[model samples]
Structure formats: C-alpha cells, structure tokens
Target: MNTATHPSESHEKLWDLIKDIKFGMLTHRHATGMMHSCPLTTQNKKLDEDSQLYFFISRKSELASALAADANVNVSYADPGKDSYVSVSGVAAIREDQAKKQALWSAPAKAWFAGGVDDPDLALLAISIDHAEYWDVKESKMVQLAKMAAAAFTGKQPRMGEHKELNLS
Candidate 1:
C-alpha cells in the first residue's frame, strides 16, 4: 500500500490514476431505489483543487432526473491494461454556469450537443467529491500472475498493488 504524507499527495495520486481513463461508470439511485449506471466521459482536463469532476448530460436524461431527486453518486474508472481502478463517491448537482461549460467544452462533446456549447439540452453535471479510493498495480501482468500463483500455493492472499482511500471532504 502506498501512503500519502499529505492530503494533496493523495489527491494527486487519485487524479493520476483516473485522468487518462476515457469513461467513468456513474452510478446513482433511481426513484425506485434501484441503482443505475451509465458511462460518461470525464470532461476535466485537469483535476480541480476541490476534487470536483464534470460531465455533460442531457437535461432530459435519467441521470439528470435522478440527481435532482437524490444527489449521492459514485463514479468508477478502470484501466485493466494498467491494472488501475478508482472509485469516487460524492454529491452531484447540475451546474448552470455558462463560463464553466465553455471552459470544459471540447469538439468531441459537440457530437452529443449538436448546437455546441450553446445547446439548451446540454447540462453540466458536477460531482463534489467527498471520498475516493484507488488501486494501482505497478507490476506487469506476468509478474502479478506469478505472485498470485505463489500466494495460492502458500494459501495466502496476494498483495498485488497499492490501495488507498481518501476523504476529500
């Protein structure tokens, strides 16, 4: 396990693990208490100091309606090739800031919002991160498999990577 001497260090580690990830599986509770998940592209080019994540969603989407009813959410990122995974839990809300939308706006997002940044149906979803946990494995797949085999022979659990949890709130 990797230990962070400071909260900022932990924050940086969390961002490093997820920044290159293309899509995050966002999960939220539905009105019927069922959990729903949808893949959303992370819009942040940089990790904010406050650890907020941004995504663009249609104002009419189920996610948008779910957040309006219940704000708690979790976003999960995985890069199996790199053996890295991150899970972030937070409160979600719709942001009405046009400047923020413009700042995070990109060409690819235009695919979803045909009217570009001025799309009325486009809503900026902000997740105010409260807690995050990550697992990052430094070893290659072959080496990790060997370690797992060794542990299996010894009847012990394999220590494959660094796992840490951070409370950003």
Candidate 2:
C-alpha cells in the first residue's frame, strides 16, 4: 500500500472503513511475545465517531491475560463486498465503569457470563486506537477476475488492493 498520504487523512479514511464493517479482529501480544487474534464486536457512544474502544471478555481469557500484561493491540476489519479494509493499533485495558458497560451491553453478550452484566467476572476491554490506514476497492468481483486474467497473460502478479497499516502503540 502507498504510504505517501498524510497520517491524518489516512486515519480518517481508515475510520470510515471501520465504521462500515462494524466488527473486527483484535490482536494481542502474549507474554511469550507471540501475537493472538480473535473476532470482536465494535461499539461506540457516538454514531459519528469511530469506535473509541472495542468491548469483549471481562475475565481471564488468553486475550485478557495478554492485555493485562501488555496493553498493545491491533484490530482489523474488511468488507468483501466493498473491497475496503482497515487496521487499528492501540493499547487495550479492562474497563470497570458500570455506565460504559451498561451502554455496550446487549442480551446476546449475557450468554458468555453466568450473572450477565452483573457477573463479577464480567470485564470490559477497551482499546484506545492510536492510528489507522485503509484501502478502498469499489470494483466488482468480475473486474478483479478480469484484471487477474490480464495479469496472468502478462506473467505478472494480480493486484488485489485490500491492504492497510496501523500503529498499535
């Protein structure tokens, strides 16, 4: 991906793409320094703003342990139909705010906790994103296929433009 654009503009475009996708994969660095990723739901208090943080796992999953030891994290989202993707980097921490928890809570999430939102084991994971980048590919699949075929004839690799970079610090 071209990294020539201003960081602010890149961040805006990435947030736009992420807003469209709604969900993303959150990655964390384990104590062993290996990275682990899991699908997570995205949420925000404001509709116009990018998700300030993503919420998942209040208790001790491997992801939670990793976050506790090291807050560094990354999240990625892509829309196949739109051919757009975004990656966000940030620090993650457990949030115990009742108001924030109530705001993000849904009945479906209760299934993961025996006492629901009231469970002592329940914890909120908050990822404070530092920066992000995005790729936009609005062309249809047929166009991509044709491009691939043409590239094959030229003995060149086909270009699939869904790529992005984010700084998770």
Clashes of each: 0, 3
Q: What is candidate 2's lDDT per residue for 70-135, written digit by digit as tens?
A: 998888887877777676777787877988788778877878877877788888887777766677
Lowest summed lDDT over 10 consecutive residues: which window, candidate 1?
1-10
Model 2 earns a TM-score of 0.75
TM-score for all models, in order of appearance = 0.95, 0.75
Off by over 4 Å in 2: 1-16, 20-22, 45-51, 153-169
Over 25-120, each residue of candidate 1 has an lDDT whose tens digit, in order, gives: 999999899999999999998778878999999999877888999999999999999999999999999999999999999999999999999999
Task: Itemize residue pairs with steric clashes in candidate 1.
Answer: none
